[model samples]
Target: MGVFPDFDGLGGIGDLKQVIGALLTVVLIVAVLMIVVSAICWALGASHGNPSLASKGRIGVLVGIGAAALAGAAVAWMNWLITLGSQL
Candidate 1:
């Protein structure tokens, strides 16, 4: 048996899963957009000698990429934790 609780036989969760998938897709798209915008902002700030704007843009880019990584890895991380717990 899997380490995860037996939600396999549960009814109606398919819809919830679909919704979650859709939301994840939306988040990914937005995060990518943010990264693009931040890159442009950083370029403009550097060209204009605005350190503050450049810093903010760099931070935004990092945050957007971090969020995207988390969203992508959450399920794998959760499964890894569960497997470790079961093995212990």
Candidate 2:
């Protein structure tokens, strides 16, 4: 007997996948925007000799990068999980 995931086992699963894809797209767009804005803030802060703003901007940039990475990896992560689950 073959044991595999039945992706069509549920109704509205296609719609759910589409929604998740759209959300991921939005997240990536926002993350990129965040990085751009943060970089600009960092430059302005550094030019103005504002250490606090510069630090905040740096943190924001890092967060944006992390968010983008996570969003990008989400699909792979989920697929990995599903594969692992099926192996059990």
Candidate 3:
């Protein structure tokens, strides 16, 4: 009576757990990478003579935020899909 436990009929939150885990893993990796990339961009921007490099770094931070948000949404979508799939 697990509803959607095991696709193979073994058991567990079945596929939902794996789906969430994958999404979270992607988000975490992206977050860490973006943080490092942002720091580098800022540092390079500070050292560079051109104004655009600094701007690019600032853009990196903004993009990082966007990426994180997108990742979160993707995770949520995945959750929704799982829920929908289970109902089916």
Query: What alpha-carbon RMSD in Å does predicted model 3 have with respect to the real structure?
Result: 5.4
Model 2 off-target regions past 4 Å?
1-8, 80-88
What C-alpha lDDT do the candidate models reach, one value each?
0.81, 0.84, 0.75
lDDT of 3 at 85: 64
Q: For candidate 3, give the lDDT of residue 84.
A: 82
The true-versus-predicted C-alpha distance at residue 42 of model 2, in Å, is: 0.5
Which residue segments of model 3 deviate by more than 4 Å? Answer: 1-20, 43-49
Candidate 3: tens digits of C-alpha lDDT, residues 1-88: 5555555553455566786788788877887688678868778878876567777877878887888888788878877876786665
Task: Give all TM-scores, in the order shown.
Answer: 0.72, 0.75, 0.62
* Inter-residue clash pairs, candidate 3: none
lDDT of 1 by residue, 1-88 (tens): 6575654454554565576678789989999999999999988899999999999899989999998998888755655755565454
By lDDT, the best candidate is: 2
Give the per-residue lDDT digits (tens) of candidate 2, residues 16-68. 56776898999999999999999999989999999999999999999999999
Model 2: how far is 53 from its true place, Å? 0.6
Error of 3 at 14 (Å): 2.9
How does candidate 1 score on lDDT? 0.81
